[model samples]
Target: MQDLAFRFLVQLEPENASNFVSLSNLHASSGRWDSVAELRTRMKKKGIRKMPGCSWINVNDEVHSFYVADKSHKCTDIIYTVLDSLLLMMKGEIDVPGLGCMK
Candidate 1:
């Protein structure tokens, strides 16, 4: 009951750190260390996340790296399919649940 209510408060105002802190306290009270940790990580990310200045990839066991807005990958069009989906999060238009995958 309290969990749902607290989570709903977070949903209502995701940008408000107080809601997240309340949720984290709830997790801590239950000894849900992992949930508390994940929430803390989310808070840090929500506050400090930034656009990538570079990216890397592995193909055929070879590593390749690229700079911001790179267009050098042979599969750039296909790779960008993944990138486009992630732009909203990168722009901080939405809360990120976990790190996104880039090609």
Candidate 2:
């Protein structure tokens, strides 16, 4: 199912802009930083500038907007910490025995 979805995503038009951006984000989430960089470069070459980074939070029926450069949100540190934890877990799982057993 995931494979089909991924293929469908990849088949999206190169001009969609968001498609490439989504692919880059997926790669980054899977620890493929180099692929993300390459995709970003491709997007730039195709004259598709990335949209400015922004986030929104809903609080008491109010939507608060936060930009990457905004000092009010520490998004960078939060993302780094999450990624660090994932990396540690991945390393530990890889070190486990019998998981990769080849009979």
Candidate 3:
């Protein structure tokens, strides 16, 4: 995994933020906090910023895109409130491992 990522970074798209983020995620999943932090620090030093991941969905014939820490939507507050309620309900029903849940 590291070999392929390094190849992509060095040969294909060295300046791409996604490459850095993917490598950081690999490190983080392996309990390598220092490596993850180092990768992020490098990205910052190189002026490379990772774009937030987003999900697109269709509701009532309208399409909406949602991103982490997003505040541009008109219904951001209400959407968050509903999501919070759903998370709380899920907490009572089962343990969602690896997912950040309302505490």
Candidate 4:
């Protein structure tokens, strides 16, 4: 599924930095840090500066914004830790129905 999405992205915008950024994000989410770093390098080579990373949350009819490198919240580390934990858990025995597979 992710491969298909990545293919589509590259097809739509072969050299777009935004597409590379999205790809890097996907790779990071999948614990593929090497790929992420590679994509980042590609972006740099293409003279593409990354768009500022921002996140938003709605609370009490107000929208709160956060940016990358903001120390107010440790969002990056927290998410990385969560993904690491999930990877560790996935390394152990896991039951899958119908496919007769275990991980």
Candidate 5:
């Protein structure tokens, strides 16, 4: 894998490159390399440039935002590691892999 960040499928706008990248990452994480290659091929044919991801938080009536591949935050790695750990724990409890709608 190309670093740990390549393991997640982040949300993206419809028909955007980030959407394809997200799907590709999802496939990679699930050991579906063929699907990842297919997604890349389609993206290449469509001339899509992978877009940066963005996330925001509302705290004390203030907004904090960040983008994928951004390195401005000092604690980004720690934050993500904690998140991954939490996700693993949740997955173990629920017997589910990957993010899916709860039912």
Candidate 6:
């Protein structure tokens, strides 16, 4: 379905951010980092800006939303630190509870 949508979008417009991002994510998940980098670089050269990711959560009857790469938040440094640690840990052999060690 995504491939079909991507093809259709390509027919209409080949350089839109959403389609590029969707295809880039597909390539990234498949360990095609070179392709991802190429697409991003092409977008940069073409002056196409990718949309920032955003999500919302309800806390104490208030809805709070945050966007990716947003540095205005006070805990941004701490969040990035923990995220970096998790990425480093995941890069090594992980001991899964049921699946055992994954290379």
lDDT of 1 by residue, 16-74 (tens): 88788888899999999999899889889889333457867788999988878778878
Ranking by TM-score: 3, 6, 4, 1, 2, 5
- Candidate 4 lDDT by residue in tens digits, 1-103: 8757985996788777777877888899999999989877877777778667898988799786778866565466786677677676666544435535543
Question: Which pairs clash in the backbone of model 6?
Answer: none
TM-score of each: 0.45, 0.43, 0.67, 0.46, 0.38, 0.51
Q: In angstroms, how far off is 78's CA in candidate 6?
A: 10
Q: How many clashes in each structure? A: 0, 0, 0, 0, 0, 0
> Which sections of candidate 6 miss by over 4 Å?
1-8, 57-64, 74-103
For model 4, the superposed segments whose C-alpha errors exceed 4 Å read: 53-103
Clashes in predicted model 4 = 0
User: Where does model 5 exceed 4 Å of error?
Assistant: 1-48, 93-103
RMSD (Å) per prediction: 15.4, 10.2, 6.8, 9.8, 12.0, 6.5
Q: How do the residues 1-103 of candidate 2 rate in per-residue lDDT, one tens digit apiece? A: 5434644765766666767777777888889899889888887888887567887879899887877666565466785677677786577743435645531
Q: Comparing candidate 3 with candidate 5, which one achieves the higher lDDT?
A: 3
Judging by TM-score, tell me the better candidate of 2 and 5.
Answer: 2
Best by TM-score: 3
What shift in Å separates residue 90 of candidate 3 from its native position after superposition?
1.8
lDDT of 2: 0.71
Clashes of 6: 0
lDDT of candidates 1 onward, in order:
0.80, 0.71, 0.81, 0.75, 0.70, 0.77
Q: What's the true lDDT of residue 30 in model 3?
A: 87
Q: Record all residue pairs in model 5 with backbone atoms less than 3 Å apart, i.e. clashing.
A: none
